[model samples]
Target: MADITTPDLPHSRHWRFSLDIEAIGWLILDRAETSTNTLSQEVLSELEQLMDPIESLAASEQMRGLVMLSDKDNGFAAGADISEFDDIAEPEVLRAALERTHRLFARLEQLSVPTAAGIHGFCLGGGLELALACHYRIAVDDDATRIGFPEVKLGIFPGFGGTGRSIRQAGPVDAMQMMLSGRNLRATQAKRIGIVDKLVRHRDTLRWAGRKAVLEKRRAKAAGLTERAAAMGPVRGYTARKMREETEKKVRPEHYPAPFALIDLFEKYGDDPLAMIGHESDAFIPLMNSDTAANLRRIFFLTEDLKKQRQRGSSFKRVHVVGAGVMGGDIAAWCALRGMAVTLQDLNMERIKPALDRARKLFQKRLKKRHLVDTAMLRLEPDPSGRGVARADVIIEAVLEDLEIKRNVFADVEEQAKPDAILATNTSSIELERIAEGLKDPGRLIGLHFFNPVAQLPLVEVVRSEHNSDEAVARGASFALAIAKSPVVVRSKPGFLVNRVLMPYMLGAVERVEKGESKELLDAAAVAFGMPMGPIELMDMVGLDVGKSVAQELGHDVPEGSQFNELVSAGKLGRKSGEGFYRWEDGKAVKGEVPEHADLQGLGRELVVPLVDATEAAVADGVVESPEKADIGVVLGTGFAPFRGGPLKARADGKV
Candidate 1:
């Protein structure tokens, strides 16, 4: 009675390959109506016409090895479908579709017999360049797997043949700092950084251990004679002049030309895996028509269409949280590190044991087991009795921004929650209708704001309030995409959309340091106008009295009688009182001299055109519905400049 009509596909005419298993010739990518497998230039032209009859069955011996699985239960592809980069917006049809995906990964690296891949979930970017032209890969000891080549977070690089098979198997400074810090790793750190070649421990034994490491011809695992003598030759010219002086001190190779063209095409093709696959298909065909990789592939299809329009099909078991501080004990230890049973109340049991010792030091720096931070502190309970907000199913309220103490803590969380729970709020500058006035069902409240060390920023915002309810803004955008974060639904104004487009670029860098300018020429003109920390050293690392009380709680203006109230009346609260406007010492930021006629590109366009006109006036005042969710809420809540994709596509490409 529970069969659900859809099980006839062992191989009904190879929809994205399916050879099954004649001693592991599995192939099977399975992309029909997709739930993950990506590489779509029509699935790399039907995987190059199904690898020409499996390369004529490995040239007649009827294939002894080949795996590349993924009938998607998790995901093995997740790459190459920047919605087919709008049908190759011509850089010679995106370098002839990246030279037909490098002649189908150089015909699966000249497969004569053994070839592998397996992976379990998210083998990213051209699916880790088809598991590095397969000769082995394996993966699957799942915490939902992960391997990499995150195409430099979509501003592009790793244009298939993943920068010459991750610098010929993990050399060139840990494969160019894992493709210039796009960072995925975790399949036991991609098998200790040789980008995985075996970690199986059952995902149905990754296609029988990737066909027993391709009929025991294993090979693929190189780089260690001290990572091939620290990338060889004159220590590869002092590691390509210290990765081009640390990628031009935070990217400015003419505004992000794919991580300085993947460190100048691997310092001009050293370790030549076929000249780094023709300089990664001529630097990914004009960086796939760069407007910074089409605004970082339109913020990777708007955070994958806001996780399918914020699904509210319910599933957030328990979760209480009410103010244990440090953003409610890191949002109750990131909802007990995502499995959620959380609780964390806090009438101070030493503030709920330092949010259970900062959620057991964030699950001992992201779980590789200290008993999975004791199974995420056995789902972090610590209530100190508000009776876990009447058996919470979502209560949040990380209190103390004050609007009558968050309307008397939402009238005692609408008198102890759960009448179909959900009452969110982590208020990063209030106004979800002023914390839903005196809430007794301000349509079950909402806002889920979360962003300050809430397990290291991935922007939550959810907001919504005209007294919420479209089922409480899809249950606060389904508990901020069920703890993984990225939410962005916005609209309850006053500093809602990323602190109202970052309180006019931090009160216009404190009115250019009270009109004299030099916080080292406005933090080196916001790291030469790309900004990953500059507006007065991000308001002295977010504490010039918490950026002047969020620019006077977002009403903004802050000009008259200034030097920002004489550096907050001389306590100089920044870097925790080390001193504001530069003087932190051993903890860095030591700025001083900049009056060599400090125009600094007109003070970085007067602190980036009022943060690109307050993100096109927050998509023209609906507070966020387009200009791609106010440029993915100021590029994931005020880090902005994801190669200038936010701030209304850097003010509609005039690049602010």
Candidate 2:
């Protein structure tokens, strides 16, 4: 290999080209004016122009190999610029763009010298597709290094030659699974699955590893016998049928069509890479222009907008959760997982032990590594004597939903907590004003209401009353964001935002069940309308006792003779007690079949109308600041049909 240390070569706004000491041409991606690199039209066009210099280097025998990497520390690239998708209204226009990208990537793939992608952080969607185009992919071994084709999440599949190349590299089943599910693969997992050729210990060594892999002419992982067999016509059909069957179990074709379309693509063209590449846009173009795609993209932007509400330079580091029940324990554990020092205060260690146990399981599932799980466990301390109150930077009370109990907790917390420390309550339905009544400085108290099963739900209702200071409210919202939850600041009121909008919907379902509608049929109706679960199923998950309490607090009429109350009185509380409207087994509702002649569509409209009405009233009464905030809150907090955008959005679009 010749040693050519050139300072300059191809010039472009989004790419840097130079020859290193080892005669390797390093093409560094640094999208101008952005913290993260994305493959925008200008970026991709600049890359094509830069390819001229790359080919010249290879032709002159001055380059040993080509290594592509990013200058951005956050990621190699966050994928294609999604903002551009809004302008693409026609399939022909999108097809033309896809064809151009396919041509450019093909040029990179056919270059004389071996090419490698030095991947760090996230290489997702188009970024992953770009990596697949390279001869080799070398990733840094770290938690941040995530690689995947996440286009399916936006109601599309990989278009820039990913469908064919990924299957060629990782084999049909693994590649299809990665594309269909839109789940990211860690560096080690990527290496095992052949998406990555090698993994370096650190980002500093990524270039060296890429160079070594290129110079040594290391052969990429070849598909095994099983992989090859799976791609055969008969076998491919069987596998794709199985994939569709499994996918339909999670999402229906009417709601999410990308996964099914991708399965069909694989079944028809999995054997021939070239043919698959040529036909890729046939499936890709239509899905990109779909209503579901548009709504999902809207949701993606909404989520990003919410993240901007995070308070920078927050002084909160230590969290004290005063209760060891499900919500409190989970909240404390989540804080610990996010690198906060959390102290869980309860009456005794016995109560705290279950929380710790649950946290251990959550850690094992999320962190995956033993050392990381251990670190999280060490951050959570059990304080039976309430000693953490004096040292905590933020004190969150998650005790029982009794007004006096919460007031008493705050009275003690106000005295022991630091004067400037934030005082928050995780009250689901109670007004923050009532919770702050006994406090010496009520203005310092804010509501940080997290939904049940804190780990799964993303929304946190940051409730503020007339008594709360603006700084207190800002800090509460910041804390929610810091813990990786989307915070929607709502005025303190009974059933604030999500629960306020959700109560009537759940109660309406219960009322219909009492009037002779089948519980399973009603649930099916909700599912057909795109709700994640039926109201009955959700009530069961929330626990019937808890549901009845929130419903009453929200001023809904829950008649004493109602099935909901009757079931609660008989000790069948819900999933917690293993029985309600539906029997619970292993955390799943065992629902019976819906009747053949059930009016699912009519029932769906009837069930969803109350939710839409409540959302309108909540926005009108100023519970949330705007319709957009209410939409995000309902969608994330209660799983309110994301494809419809939200209740407010659905209403505006006349989709409800």
Candidate 3:
């Protein structure tokens, strides 16, 4: 409102306040910090500071209605600024903060006239909670505009009266699912489910949201959004983050206090929306303060950062796989998903079927989701005897790890491939330079390593050898991206980044088992240490044979006192062979007879320490531990727990 601005208040967020004599007052909720306004602590404080404006105006009969809108192109408000949660201390402190926020929202709600939140662009978490606090909400119908409380993912939930408010407005069923799943709702879907009072197209937003606010003459009779959100489904949703807490329950059971504190705030203070909202504001203290959350957040940002990273300047458009076994099938499927034409080849049909089948399933899943067209599967083709090798821009050799076999595949694939084609090996154990030596044009050779079940894992290892050209490295990375994977370039060393670190860790784990450390204790301790799977459990997934092979690749001098290789020789091939450190029955891992302890490092980080502090201290100045090598080996070699960010990072974090 033109008449509403405090003469002394600074306009730091680039917001302008003005009142319209036309009866509908206007306030542009703009923030200059970024392109969008995040409902940060400062924003909540500002919102509280401004509440007196409407109350004072109404008391003096200066304004009849108010329209809260964002001047920015794609947002109303993106909820509570999560950055504030970075250093929260205690649950009580968090609760106090929520109480303060509740007071702010309550003040805004008590206006005698009417209030409306005009939402667009990422109406998520606290942002949507703010809108729910308003008397009425109008959203612009556009793909960019979405509504959801995604706090559950971070082991938190909408603390700003969102669970209660949305439940009241949308009723129990929809409200519970919305918060629990933290699923997004488009404006159209929002209207259908009664989550939004009204949906307006982008052009009609101001007019509709403003008119709807002034038109909403009736005072909210019962508890609105928060009340409804708490009462949904058989789950009997509470004013707390019950919907979201379900995930936390399964994910962090041992760390009950972390998730429970969040739920406790909601259950304890939710009755009065104002009180619960106040409680909500302070929730960040315990939620953010906990070490569990800290670790989870660290992991979250770590992997998320990888996803956002790109291969600098290079772009890969085509990829070719030189084998069609389970690994190659997964590789091809991943390529197709990321908008790449993948030519999967095998020496014969025996190997070809597995790769083709894997790709077929991957594409079928996409078809079900409608993310890829049903016709996209036609792009995948099989080449027995390396027929498509020459036409490919990048060729990945997914053949066995056998030295002679890998060398032979390289020799044949090189002969068939174009002069400029980047030849890569999916070999997990073989040294890249040695295999490249088998090629005439060694400069064209590199390692394009993918994990088994490539469609799922996000990592790919791009091995750059001395002979490899920058062009080859660039394309290898591009192909990794083309397959929708995170490619971390590593040095041309045996076992690459992940395994190099992992060898010692595994040897340590096996040694621990061999040393009479109870399997259950080791697993429990590791789990408590935040590893997704314990060492022995991991060995089962990695296939005893694969694990032994990688260990052997690490050489006889790799680590002393681990009998895993001996076990592999004794017929334990891990999950596939149904025996390793554990037994596999019906696709699930079960503890096997405790093998004799083979303890290597004893306790703590002594077992698997970081080789060198600086890259210069290690093998070379620029060696990267391959996430691809780590992920694939973990997935294929030992089932290292995909969501846990693999053993390389885990070992580094655990060891260092």
lDDT of 1 by residue, 1-656 (tens): 01112222333332444444354466667777767788787766777766777777678775676777778887788877777687786888778778878888889888888888888878887888887898778787778878777777777777777787777787778778888888888788878778786787778877667767777878686666777665566676677778889877767777777887777777677566578777777777777677877777777778778888556468778888777877888888888888888878768688788778877878998885888889889888888777888888888878777778777878887986779888877877777776677666686788788777677788898888786767778777877887888887888777777777777877777776677756777767766777777777777777777677777887665554677767877889777678887778776777767656445555575677887887787778888877887787778777777766777667666756
Model 3 lDDT per residue over 239-309, tens place: 34543456464544444343455456545653444455444555555556655555445544554455443
* Model 3 segments more than 4 A misplaced: 1-123, 134-156, 166-249, 253-257, 269-275, 300-314, 348-350, 359-367, 370-394, 407-423, 438-448, 467-484, 515-517, 556-572, 592-622, 625-656
The backbone clash count of each candidate, in order, is 0, 0, 48
For all predicted structures, in order, the TM-scores are 0.36, 0.97, 0.71
- Every model's Cα RMSD, please? 20.3, 1.7, 6.7
Better of 1 and 2 by TM-score: 2
435-477 in candidate 2: lDDT tens per residue?
Answer: 8886778899898899878898888989999987778888888
Candidate 2 lDDT at 441 equals 83
- Model 1 TM-score is 0.36
lDDT of each: 0.76, 0.88, 0.64
* TM-score winner between candidates 2 and 3: 2
Highest lDDT against the true fold, candidate: 2
